[model samples]
Target chain A: MKDRKPLYLMTPALAWLTAFMVIPCLLILALAFFRRGLYGGIEYTFTLENLALVFDPLYAGIFLKSAAIAGLSALIAVIIGYAAAFAIAAAPSRRQPILLFFAVLPFWSNYLVRTYAWIVLLNREGLITGLARWLGYDAEMPRLLYTEGAVVVGLVYNYLPFVILACYAPLSRLNPEIAEASRDLGASSWTTFRRVVLPMTVPGIATGFVFVFVLSIGNFVTPALLGGGQFQMIGNLIYAQFLTANDWPFGAALSMVLIAIMMGLLTLQTFATERASGAKREES
Target chain B: MASLANPRLMLAILAAVFAFLYVPISVLVALSFNDGGLPTAWTGFSTRWYGELLHNRDIMSAAFNTLVVAVVSTVLATILGSLLAIGVEIRRRKGRFLETIIFAPMIIPDIVLAIALLSFFSLLNVTMGLHTVILSHVVFNLAFVCSVVRARLKTFDWSIVEASTDLGASTPVTLVRIVLPVMLPAVIAGALLAFTLSVDEFIIAFFTAGAGRDSITLPMQIFAMIRFGVTPEINALATIVMAVSVIALTLSQRLNRGGLPGQ
Candidate 1:
């Protein structure tokens, strides 16, 4: 009875997950191999055309563009977030919790609201344009909204706090003595950070980077609203295939590819984390 | 070491980052109160838009649907997740496969899950609605709740359970009398977090909600409104939604002082 307790306790959740998550994901994999019907329904016959179409130049270009945008957003988020985390870690210990709390507070709010906030600020009659006009010689307002920059900004804004939290974990846990030892060895601050602190914090950086990149690449909302329906990230393409275009097979194929990219990044992140911990163990 | 770097430089970075995080949100909140409700100029402060929100049937229905989904899903997730956490933690041999199964929902891209569930439902001929949205939301919500409960369980002492059994207390009685009290805070914390996530979750709900205006959630409504254009009513609605999530999450963080979900 004692041994069986654990099994019984876990059954409901396991059953729920298998019925909902696992089966659905596998169904998507199967759906990708089928053909689309003339009327937008799934055809019973199996075909690899959807997979081949994913690799075609037209769709492939969207994938590359999505990767580039996700990459750029990840890079900017890491830089800004790392700096913020570093500053928080350097603050007085008493103040650190309050600071970190406030830093992460906005992240818990409605993501659409946060994204909408950007639209309010970047639109033609937005605060930025208004500020520019107030401070300036009369000139035509630049098109700030409905651009690639707006999408990138939206992605970074929505995901930045997670990066800060990730980076701050390693930074906060870091032994200051390690940095002091480097400084005492006559290394400059820059050299100390690059060679000593940065290497140790690679796990955090990897986690943050992979997280932002994966989410950004699959993001449809930011591109749809901020890109003004003009920019077509892989997310937008997939959305069209499913909702508007009614190409379920193609959508599933694109999703499989997205999952592949995500798994690859996640595997890399795990390797980085393991290596970082192994290095720490050796150092001690 | 802290003295080695310019304190002023650190403060500047902190200031800049905080501004980046808060400025956009602050703008939305401020604009919600603007009488004219246009970004171009603020005529005066007014609560007219918020008043308008009350009279808007679409917004009201969506808000009610969101409430139904969030409450139902959070309850279901909390019970299942807490039990799973206890079971997983109690087992002496934890497999990597089991860990992956538990963690998958947290890391899986929202788009992937959204479409997967969408496809799965349609294939089964299950009519999608607020109920389907609730079902899908549970997939991720349970994962989050489990992790939180599991984090709390990490510091849990099994000796107490052993002692309770030694006293001839039955397992169910021990769980009810001993375990439940100790775990209540974390359980509630996890439920609050789940509620917030469900309320704000859009993509999955959007996909699984089928083609019906009645089942629309707050975030889906917000997304549709935002695409058309930002309006003063949306500003007011956004403010309310943000406030609810912020408050729930703050209470969650307070209870589960160990860490927030992602962190």
Candidate 2:
């Protein structure tokens, strides 16, 4: 095996990725500086106009709104998912895998189908309304579908499994003795959890938050389907720029911005995780 | 403290979550068989929707296109991914840059990759179709397959390969007779996973399928039909698509000795 130098075997996959992914991404970075053609083709002429356009109030407003919605969804998902993961980890050890599987199964299904399920649940004549009417309240049903709440619900539901998986890590690995020792020292369960458990799980929550945030912020599907064209996220804007508006360079620029936002969040998340892990090690 | 995690309450919540996830799917499945299409009312059961799907030319063509893409992409990815996994593990150093590049396809927002591919294809004047979509799908699919195979390979014993080589087996001969046999299950599992992913993938396909009705894959068709508003046929199609993914994943899991937890 030593004589063979297996690096040659790695070349095909590396070459394929570089040609398609790395090079293309770099191409988009370069393309962002070029001028948009009058007829949607890119002109090689250099300009900062595309990046400047992203900062313009109209698109900037969408970016802020997207961040708000993504943040809300991530926050809510982590709360529910952390509680659930805590419950599962606190269960018998033998059962954790099965519980986690069920928790994550919805995530592996078609993304469109999962989002569509919420449409069935939230539409005017949908399940929630049907239940409301079934309770004999004949008042006009408020518009629920295509709202900000519905979008949040879709994002939370779609990204919730990842939250569970992320949160489960710290929960399952948590040393019960520390919490017990805290309790023995006269701390109440809530106090122990607040002072100890929560701090321990912060890194997991940060991870789940960043993941859900990054994915949901760049998500086109939920906004397209659940928000129903009334609201536009960065993802939907990018989609429209490419497909509907026929503006490739602009779309490329939006994608670059999206990538930058994701990378920034990810870097922050990594730093948070490293710091937390360091604290954990130091305490140990 | 124990009562806070009440067994009944936990069971109920678990049931509720599963019901929340599964009921709509089950409803879609049932509605596809309903003679009447509305969710509000369920008439007698029938196979009419499935029959209709079978005969629908557009859906059939889309399904065919999806199959072609999935099969070709999965095969290519599995081969590339398996070899890459073996290579990386065997070599095992000084490729952090390559590792990040390979892993980027996995973590990069799908929209970013999708539009990047669209831009890349157009910039190259590459004629886009199922072919271009296949190329794009392979980019990510290979990453997934490599990860899966590499996980299994981490537990692999290298001495046998060394011993085989010492016994004068050629590299190609040793790979075929030794490494391939040991890695067969993982490769198949990886292929199934890749196929499932390729089948369910929408965004990249949406961008790279070019300007033609001919290249419309099932998910793209599903997206369009969905936008045209809910139909029993879509419910039927959704049920089928979900079933394919579930079955593929379940099979892959069983083959993989319990699938990767995060997938």
Per residue, candidate 1 scores C-alpha lDDT tens digits across A1-284 of 26568888899999999988999999999999999999999898999999999999999999999999999999999999999999999999999999999999999999899999999999988889889989984788779999999999999999999999999999999889989999999999999999988998989999999999999999999999999988799988988888999999999999999999999999999999999899889978
TM-score of chain A of each: 0.98, 0.97
- Tens-digit lDDT string for candidate 2 (A11-89): 8988899888888889888888999888888889999899999999999999999999999999998887887787787
Candidate 2 clashing pairs, residues 3+ apart or interchain: none
Q: How close is candidate 2 to the true structure, as a TM-score?
A: 0.95
lDDT of 1 at B250: 94
Residue B246, model 2: Cα distance from true site in angstroms:
1.1
Model 2 lDDT, residue A258, Cα: 86
lDDT of 2 at A69: 99
Instruction: List, in the given order, the native-contact fraction of each candidate.
Output: 0.74, 0.45
| Model 2: residues with Cα > 4 Å off, grouped in runs | B1-16, B258-263
**TM-score for chain B of each model, two decimals:** 0.96, 0.94
Please list the C-alpha lDDT of all candidates, in the order they appear: 0.92, 0.86
User: How many angstroms is residue A125 displaced in model 2 relative to the true structure, after the best TM-score fit?
Assistant: 2.6
Model no. 2, DockQ: 0.53
